[model samples]
Target: MHSQNNDKKIIKKFNESESLVINEFDKSGIISFAQKDVSNSFLRGTSNDFIEESTLYWTMKFNKYANDFFKKLTSDKYNFNQGMLKVFKNDMYEENNSKNYLLINSADDIKEMTNCHLIPILKNIIHAPKEDMGLLAESLVHMTLLKRKFSIDQEETVGGAIVVVIISKSDGFIWKEKKQYYSNESNKHLEYVNYYKSQ
Candidate 1:
């Protein structure tokens, strides 16, 4: 959705930073990714094949973003798993169902959904107006976060929790960017606070 000049500028910036730029376009919006920004630790035990690795990275990024968002905001100890993230998008947001929750309805035919769970997303995307991609992305991420939290508190697996979402509206412009070290320190401090508060 960007102008040619803007695209050029993006490419130039990535070139300068020695980062691999990946641009994916869908009806919802464009996803621009920099390979370097993705953490290698998140790729642990994942496939080595390029396509498989990228798919895992994308999924992990969603988990990472959600985890990063809640790094210090809560006392709950849990993680957002990939299954919960999938349910958030596929079941709640109707990603794999009717696709009606999409910001743009350009498909030839929307899939007919018989039994939808209809779990409410953090931000109501039922009739969201399309203007800013960053807001849309953030809302989706938050929805995943909420789902993962529920899974951790109630679900059997891991007795827990993951999802990452990112957006860069402009060059060097990260949407709600939280530095890695800052998040780490905040999480540690919160651990101490949670211990003392519990005591």
Candidate 2:
């Protein structure tokens, strides 16, 4: 996890979950944000009731990060719904039984799930890994299969390595751009890109 000290960023990287932690410097405001940089558009819908909004934002961010990572390199891991970004405010969804995919609208309800996270129950992943136990290998294979079908991690059995690389680079660029935006916060959205950097 990442935290801040005297305003400088502190980074903590995790290999198991590919998760990162960043802090706000006060020490306790630590959130579970991913490695991707947070933007003002993040606060776009953040309202007086921030809990739900933040939860939704977190969920959407992960989906978008995953989607964008595969897309930048023209990798096949880009899941189909990612292309739907132009038309919707969010792009996360889940499926129930066969032939019926339920679109998840409640972002804060972690229990309901996006419905996408239910692979082991909905689909049997029995033969995923040849080098490990059936369950772990099966699960990995299942996830890898999704990554493959999504066209995320190609060129190896991992399924989504390339996507992660793409997300990291894009996120870094985003941080640079975000820093520029905060440097000049008074400007309107249309031309903040140029004016923000000047300050």
| Candidate 1 structure quality by residue, lDDT tens digits, 78-160 | 55565655555445423412332221121111111100111122123334543244465544345444544576554332112
Q: Compare the candidates by TM-score and give the number of the best one.
A: 1
Residue-wise lDDT of candidate 2 within 104-177, one digit each (tens)?
32322432332233323223323332223223323434454454466543433344332211112212222221
TM-score of 1: 0.21
- Show model 1 residue runs off by greater than 4 Å: 1-131, 152-199
Listing every candidate in turn, what is its Cα RMSD in Å to the true structure after a full C-alpha superposition?
Answer: 25.3, 26.9
Q: What's the TM-score of each model vs. the native? A: 0.21, 0.17
lDDT of 1: 0.33
Candidate topping lDDT: 1
